[model samples]
Target chain A: MAETTDLDVAYVARLARLQVSDDERRTFQAQLGDVLRYAAKLAEVNVQDVEAAAHAVPMFNVFREDRPRDWFTADEALQNAPRSANDLFIVTKVVE
Target chain B: MTAAELPALTISELQPLLRGGAVSPGEVVDALQSRISEIEPQIDAYIALDFEAAKHEANAADLSLPLGGIPIAVKDIISVAGQRCTCASRSLSNYIAPYDATLIRKLKAAGAIPLGRTNMDEFAMGSSTENSSVKITLNPWDKSRVPGGSSGGSAAAVAAGAAFGALGTDTGGSIRQPAAFCGIVGLKPSYGRVSRFGVVAFASSLDQAGPLTKTTRDAALLMNAIAGVDPQDSTSLPEPVPDYTQLLGREIRGIRIGLPKEYTTDGIDPQVKAAVDAAVTQLQALGAEISELSLPHTEYAVAVYYVLATAEASANLARFDGVRYGHRTEGVANLVEHYERTRAEGFGAEVKRRIILGTYVLSSGYYDAFYLRAQKVRELIRRDFVEAFKKVDLLISPTSPVPAFKIGERTADPLQMYLADIFTIAANLAGICAISLPCGFATSESGTQLPVGLQLLASSLDEARLLQVAHAFEQSTDWHQRRPPL
Candidate 1:
């Protein structure tokens, strides 16, 4: 188990793509620190031979025969987009 | 029956009236619309209502279908084609679903009208609707207190007679907790029993859409339409769907019911404990064999749930960047700034808090300690249920540790609010079917009468037996018949 410590809220916020204000950073740091401390209880449990379960019920991969089917038109697909031009979603420039 | 009396009828009761030519489906919609206009100011249950379109659909409803002519309110998170699927977040506040969720499609095929979108905790994050970016849904029983949340609006709408039934998604006790608070029947079918194709994703593995209604039979009736495999959601099970109402009036003789010792601890309110105890006795008198058992890992559920659910949430919510849909920041220099600012502006505080926590737990070095460890502990929790179910057909407990608390009560402390779902979270972790129904009432110090819920759990895909037992208990007690003073 990794040693528990204060959460670096600013760093985590940046990683999450969420811009946190200075006040929010301070509040979140304290609150998340408390939650992490409570979550540290899991470290005490013996899990030597246990398998990690990503889902509660066992699931199997489902596949269907490859076939072309009618789906959303470009207009329907772009209906809720924040910005769209032609048939594609518009966003901030990625490459210079 | 007069139009005023139509809102008080359950889906099952309304079906006969519609079939027997006594009432039209459009009249039901109008009655509910009138009721909504009268009580909605106090409850604030619905986020949006489109009765014009609902009445349009109701006019053509086929009475031959199972749920014919019933108007089921939908939680804002589920897509219903043209309706706004805001998820009670500013991020998706103006967004409209381009297509219906598989569950909505099934309900429509069963002749049910999708009435309106109800409020919820922002992105289904908090225990109380106070976390909702839209509005807080007050408990219909006591307007000063909260309708326990994420699905608070759905439960309150049903309890207040503004909706015949409603759809709610449960990740960790969202449906059951609110239902317990509002004094209604809420079912969380076993994971993967319902499709998640168009429902907004929270914790993908844990979330299941189910019914919030006035009675167990109504839940069973709604469940019959919603449960089944869907090609759109890969995780949905391929098992044969059964008639959920098949065992409704069957005798529960010799049915083994277990009471978990871990759940009977001191944190539970005394009134809540007494209600569940009396419910156990009632079930015993109805011929169920009650015994004490242990699901030893019960204490770690909230901890494990927080870590895993938040981790999954962080990944799932990444789709909300300012590109394809929803909110977009006006001024930004580049892609990175656009992503950051848009999310910061769009998501509410609780959603942001969870996103940060999720990212941290799944971050470098701490992954093994928090994320993976929680998953392993999650396995242990599931195993505990598996072992206990071997000795009993079902388990019983209080859905929430306490009844509906004051609106601003737990808002200051997130952990305190998370603890309110103590009893209901374990079933989601264990991938089991569970139901919360009205068992009794708890009177607050201020002299407000609040509803207490009795929770029943059965192994995965055993909804038939779960509904049977819940129906038996509900039929024997007058609890389901008690109406709020609205």
Candidate 2:
């Protein structure tokens, strides 16, 4: 496990698109450090020959006839948008 | 049953009454509404109750259907069209669901009324409902203690007679742990057994929605309504659905039940261990064979779960940016700042902690060490179950290491709280079916009785046997009939 001091909490939080307060950063750094340290126990297991399993049950690709089906209308889709104009979700200006 | 007593009856009990014209569906809703009004203030089990809508549905309920007119509370995380799908988070506090989750759609199709939205940990993140951005759901047994969470509110409502039965989602013990703490039955079907469509994702690989109910039979009845393949959820198994209640009265004369030694180690509460041991003896008396077995990889389950579940959560929750449905921030300089500030202000401490940890593990420098390693260990955990089931029909243990702890007790220490779910996480990791039912009760430090849960785990798609055994044990004991002082 990486040392607790080694985790750049602010940088990771930014990567996660979260803005943590200084207090939150300090608190999460300690709490998450402990969690990661505990999780480090996984390294002791001999997984050299074991293949990683993403889903416990084996999955196969499912297919259906290529056809459209009834779904939410445009108005219904944008009904929950925090900000919308016409049928589009309004957002902060981009590509400035 | 009189109107005053209607709210306390289980779905199985009320079904006949509703069918016989002895109790109208409208009356059931009225009785439940009154009962909810009386108990909800103390328990805070519900986030929102829509009596007007529920009554309308009840009045038109098709009595011929299985769950007709039965009112089931829903965890706020699952979408119920036109109801608030807050997920007990401030981010979606004003967000009403535009569509019903597939599970909700199935329940309604079976004639069940979606009665109220129950509180939960923010995005179903915490073991105790203390992390809920809304109000804390208090244990019905003792208000000083918490109802186990993120399905805490659903479990509490069922326990306190605020609702007959409720829907809960289990990612890492969310349903079963709370059900254990509240002294009810909670089932986590084999991962693909239930549809996850429209249910807010926590850890997609781990999450499965199931029932929290007053009796195993009610759980089976709910399971019958909800479990099936859904084209909407690609991971939903294409396996045929069974009559989960068919094995309720079947004999278990030669069924092999394994008791994993690791689950009974020193960290468990003495009384909890005693109760589970007694339950094992009772199952033996009922003609089941009990044996001690090892699931050596057991200790690493919570470790692997936290890593994988949080990793998935960090990705799943990315959709909650300010541009869309949930909470948005004002006065942000740019889109990036808006996303950061919105999430920062919206999520609770535990959610933030998990997101950060998840982000760190998946980040460039640590992916192979943390995320990949956890998945491989997760496979080992899954293999442990696969190997154990070869010799035993089911595995039994205490659902939680201890009963419901007092509210605010473990909130400050996240790791301590994480460890509380140690016994229940492995089932999710293995993607197997499991259930928790009230095996017995233990007196707390203050002498109040708290429920102890007996967990039963079966191989993937073995819910029929799981329900059969749980029902047999439940019927053999008075634990399920014991009501809280409330």
Question: RMSD in angstroms, candidate 1?
Answer: 0.8
TM-scores, chain A, per candidate: 0.92, 0.91
B1-486: candidate 1 lDDT, tens digit per residue: 799999999888888899999999888899999999999998999999999999999889899999888999999999999889999999998899999999999999998999989989999998888888888889999999999988999999999999999999999999999999999999999998999999999999899999999999999999999999998888898999999999999999999999999999899999999999999999999999999999989999999999999999999999999789999998789888999999999999999999999999999989999999999999999999999999999999999989999989888778888888889899989889999999999999989899999999999999999999999999999999999998
**Ten residues in a row with the worst lDDT in model 2 chain B?**
B1-10
Per-residue alpha-carbon lDDT of candidate 2 for residues B306-410, written as tens digits (9 for 90 to 100): 999999999999999977698999998988899999999889899999998898889887888889989999999999999999999999999999999999999
Q: Candidate 2 regions off by >4 Å?
A: none
**Which residue pairs collide, candidate 1?**
none
Q: Evaluated with DockQ, which candidate comes out highest?
A: 1
Taking all chains together, each candidate's TM-score versus the true structure is 0.99, 0.99
- TM-score for candidate 1, residues paired by index: 0.99
lDDT of 2 at B388: 99
lDDT by residue for model 2 over A1-96, one digit each (tens)?
545456789999999999999999889888888888888887788889888889999798787677898888999888889899989999998878
List lDDT for all candidates, in order. 0.93, 0.93
